[model samples]
Target: MSRASLASLPATPPVLAEFDELLKMRELLLAEPDEATASAVMRRFWDICCGTTDPERVGVLEAAPQYAVLRAFFSVRWGIHLRRLETLASREILADASATDLSAASMLALENYRGIDGELDLLGESPAHNAVVLGCGPFPETLIGLQHSALVGESLTGVDRNHEAVALADAMTRRLCAPRPTVTITHADAEGVDFPAFDLVVVANGLTGKTRLLDRIHRTAPPGVRVLVRNPTLLARMLYDHVDPGPRSGWRVTERRATTALSETLLLERGEHA
Candidate 1:
């Protein structure tokens, strides 16, 4: 991942020997497998995820070879860890206007949300707009900004695998988002949710196998439905490469737009190539 993406993580990283172990572990798992090392690494990972507010926990896995395993682990664990952190954040900080950003993660999230305003502006405004955001996360910044700023077509729905996160988003939206645009938050895993037809579908940050959701959008959304996938630049690939789509994947990058410093936002269309 880009060190920038790891901004919230610990200052110091692992030592060389431990780093070597991680790469070897990835190789072993790719070839023969290492339950003992895997178990220990996962334990340490969970410990770090729970103990700190670091978003991506940079160097947690230490190398690109373990990208697949780390991505899979994050896909399942983020909802749990982030929710735990958010619950604490809500109780301690979010109530204060000064802490609206909550943590580095939420700040980055809010920036990403704001960055999309231009693209949505280009798309123009419409009434009673139906939009869906996947991996909406613990905060509703993107949903709220998209709803009010770009005049995102009317109603916005945020989806996440974490039930608490969904509830938190709903509450936050009700508390903070502009009332002119209605929003709904749903609890559903990206892998299994009953994908709804939407005028716009956003595959937000922190979603694993990001291409999977893009492919799903193509399958469930109507023709011409606009899909925006947040991909990382080369610098951030260490953190997001696992979720990127391959060349054969039908979804094409129709247009590129500016987003947060951490991401490369791509405009994509469902069921057709642009």
Candidate 2:
């Protein structure tokens, strides 16, 4: 589809310049009398903007002409990739299918998490860490994969308000993972739930009270706990003015990793100090 909101974003001077170039490219594509040439240009643009293997490599694309345009274009592609992954993760969890048979969307989602884990590992952190997943959907196959990857430990607990989602997650745990790790699924709105102390917290697919819930989690969690979020709307908001919940909450804008075609993923870690 279209991500004009993301494509037309207003950011730093460099980012703005990039957007301007993308606009110029779009105009050229529209004005070109030959459709084939326009298509070729578009393809080249996508390759330059969206083909980075890792986050560090992401900046490399910016060195090309119209860097902002290419970066913005790729950012949109990354967002789309994340949405597809979320859908695949949900489907695989609900259906309990083998990973080999997973849809391309699901594969991308898995890759996105792997990328995040890789980045975290590069920071010299252990993968066998405790994590909490908020908004565990009717199918949390992605979370299951995370557990298997050692990105999460048996101490993992998932929270959700929907009974159906909780029941489904529990069922999947019983069927897929035996003597299951400390995977508990609670049916409670994220805003009111009593979150346990976790080394990492994951918030996926929920927008309501995200900041407020994060505030509570920050207050309750120990310093240095990592918070991973994959919400498109929330991430977009962060690009503009900061969302201040007060001194108790200090969040630094981190990286945005690609998940699928319709969604964007963000990695946020709470500050070490209160």
* Best candidate, lDDT: 1
Candidate 1 segments exceeding 4 Å error: 1-94, 97-114, 118-128, 241-248, 272-274
Best by TM-score: 1
Candidate 2 weakest lDDT stretch, 10 residues: 233-242
lDDT (Cα atoms) of all candidates against the true structure: 0.59, 0.55
Cα misplacement distance, residue 184 of candidate 1 (Å): 1.0
Residue 163 of model 1: what lDDT?
76
Candidate 2 Cα outliers beyond 4 Å, as residue runs: 1-125, 178-180, 233-249, 272-274
RMSD of each: 9.8, 9.0
Candidate 1 lDDT tens digits, 1-274: 4324433434334432333443443344445335455445544544443343334444444454444444544434434444455555444444665544434344434455567676565455443258888888667667867766645546788998877778778877776676766788888887675455577877776677676667777677766677777776432444454354445666666677656554667776544433
Write the residue-wise lDDT of candidate 2 on 145-247 in tens digits: 6666555655777787767668767766555554545677778888776545677777765435677777788778777777766653322321111233344
